[model samples]
Target chain A: MRWNYLIAGATAAIVGSTSGHATTYMTPAQARVAMFPSAASFIDRNVVLTPQQRSVVQKIAGIPVRAPKIMAWEAVDAAGKRLGWVIVDRVLGKHEFVTFALALDAGGAIKGIEVLDYRETYGDQIRNLKWRAQFTGKRHGATLQLDKDIKNISGATLSCRHVTDGVKRLLATYDAVLSDHG
Target chain B: MVLSDCLPPMMPSFQIMGELERRCRPLLGTFVEITAPHEKAIAAGFATIVKVQSLLSAHDPVSELSAVNRLGHRRSVTVDPWTAEVLQRALFWAEASCGAFDPTLGGLMAARGLLARNDSLLPLDPQANWRDVHVTNREVWLDRPLRLDLGGIAKGFAVDCAIDAMRAVGVQCGLVNAGGDIKGFGPEAWPVTIAMPGSREPLAMVELQNAALATSAGHDASGGLDMRHLAGASPAIASVTVEAASAMDTDALTKILVSATLKSVVCLGLAGASALTIFVDGRVIPFELKEPTA
Candidate 1:
């Protein structure tokens, strides 16, 4: 392995600039149309969780409820037939924020999910101790520049665990409130 | 002046960039993002990825790869042409790397609990290697009972397939990124940033033009060198990144470079790829392939 490492000074020059920018993949309206193309229209059916409903959602989801309000819409065909529901939610990580839309059939089964926007932000103080513990052996915690031009990232695959967890919580929200609202 | 008048007039000497459409969806146990000039092109690219995932995923019990592992020892099983193509390419790498990049490490992966065991299949053969598996046209069979995992290479193949799908739709420029196995082709270069292992810190930046780049790293959580996909080799480096013409080659090459030998160097040369090994101490080393003697 040592013989293979002939140090070359050909590494690409690092651009020095820092700007916080979120990559918006889709909007809620676009996502609604994309997830349910056949639906004629969407009806706003946003919900605000009561204290009891929040507790129920937390119990069912196995994750805490960060917000009481949830943005959602009901997709109906031309003849007033219910196509499905679209729920928009956001998952906040220590360094990332992911806003996504989840679509479910009338029976609450997941139809599809589309990420609306993904933002990675760095703070002065890292809050997640457990996540930080993974890199305790590093000599330095290098500061990353969240540049808009750098669109692609290559490295150890970042786990979408937060989004997965967020999906589970949204499902619980559906069971707790949206399921019996008809 | 007369000769200049014969040429077509220059229209501002500026090109209008197309409106890029981007979308991300959860697929293949990860987020698959596709960016193209049109919505239809992006949709087609994603559909191709979804198809590849359905055909090649080892986590799905009904996937063609799972079927091959479950019953290939009993009888030859025919798979989709896409699956066959991926399998043939995998076998080629397995031979080129001299078992260094074997696909038959699924048994070990299952034993390590990295892969779920399918109870319906017979007990795994401890000595099973790539040699035990044979591919004849679209039919595949195993000489002994052994699992097959395409987790390392399938994601890259999916990215490549998605690129092909977008190109088929007359898309001249596009990018498909499946959990960091990135491939982009356009009139201009795509800038990519490499993140440090276990953290979101940018380690290096590389510009990709009509090529793919893949990075494989260990997840020891202690910043130690430990990879789950390696069968019997102990990799000294923390991460390996390969840039090649195709995502599939780059993906497989990253694994082969984990414990690269002189033979692997020749293999890299043959594949027209270059590699960079980043140490645990944050040192990035590029491979220097010496030309063979006449």
Candidate 2:
């Protein structure tokens, strides 16, 4: 099984991304609207947390904050009211990683999660809307552990754990970086 | 609505490039990526994928396929036009591949716990092959107790459906790649890399000019040796990639090549289609590209 994984991983690395590999499941603009259909506008921002801020994010998210720099978008309505934040993040699966977006409301609660691109043959159960709905309404400081809080799919255990961990990290980033500010 | 103007001066306006947009969603047990020039075309592409998924998903209990599998063995069940069309194509391949690409393996797969059960009836009949599957007047009947699984073929057909949708929306050039099964339509020839089995780099790159490509590896879904019937066909080949005029044909051809002996591989060539086989020992064999003699 392990040997097969290595081969699968290697094969996926090649086939998943080649010259014509810019296969996007949803563009940032589309995802922003899907997560917040009534949003009047969006503001894109590139963030690189300070060492102190990174430490704070790590403490809150309970996961190591690797690459403290990220690009996040803020979606707002026509009335200038903030709708939510859309952050695209990638997490490694059994073979290749899945690119996804974690949408959060102004209060740091999850609004929705959308898978952007998945390269693995298995462990795709994470893309189910029912599976993603579990994270809705979850806020920072919530215990976002797999099996305990998030239900694990029978075949997609690795993706389940890793995505759960990724969500925790994103929530922690929100609490540390975007929670109090606009 | 000029929503951008409503934002405060502090918020920067985002400029969306109206170039080709690709979006992926989970469907057909894998991520289906649809690309188009505009949002409307993209939406249509996805609608096609969703439509096929809802109609054909063997695991989705509410799918039309589940209904057919649940009751077709007992009585002839009429299916949607789309279902009938896909089933017809599946039967064509089942015959073309000589049971090598059998949809009747649903029972065997389910018994092995590879697929979720659609009904309590098990396809235990060894004689239950594609020959026993009867289709007429958009209705289907199985002579024996075997469930049909279109997993190997439906996905490719879905890609074709998406391409058709894209064309319907007036998109000139775009491609839909569901996992590794790809179909490039319109003007541009999309470039693709055929990844070697268990390697992180391309074994070969080809310019896909309005063509369809499908690959099958020796490793199963669980990343273990695939003991499927292909083992008896060619045990040395680790992976097989086939390019044909349509995704549906490429999808079925890969299965035939994966399980075919080298001599049989040479005999299965069809015009406008070609195949390349990679062995576990790193040997690469490209089959003669010629039309099949019916």
- Compare the candidates by DockQ and give the number of the best one: 1
Worst 10 residues of 1 chain B by lDDT: B5-14
Best by lDDT: 1
Candidate 1 overall Cα lDDT vs. reference?
A: 0.75
Categorize the docking of model 1: acceptable
C-alpha displacement of B201 in model 1, angstroms?
2.1
What DockQ do the predictions score, one after another?
Answer: 0.28, 0.06
- Displacement of the residue A44 alpha carbon in candidate 2, Å: 13
- Model 2 chain B — which ten-residue stretch has the worst lDDT? B5-14
TM-score of chain B of 2: 0.85
Q: Candidate 1 residues B217-273, lDDT tens each?
A: 854434333577666444457778888888998988888887665567867876787
How close to the true structure is residue B154 of candidate 2, measured as C-alpha lDDT? 85
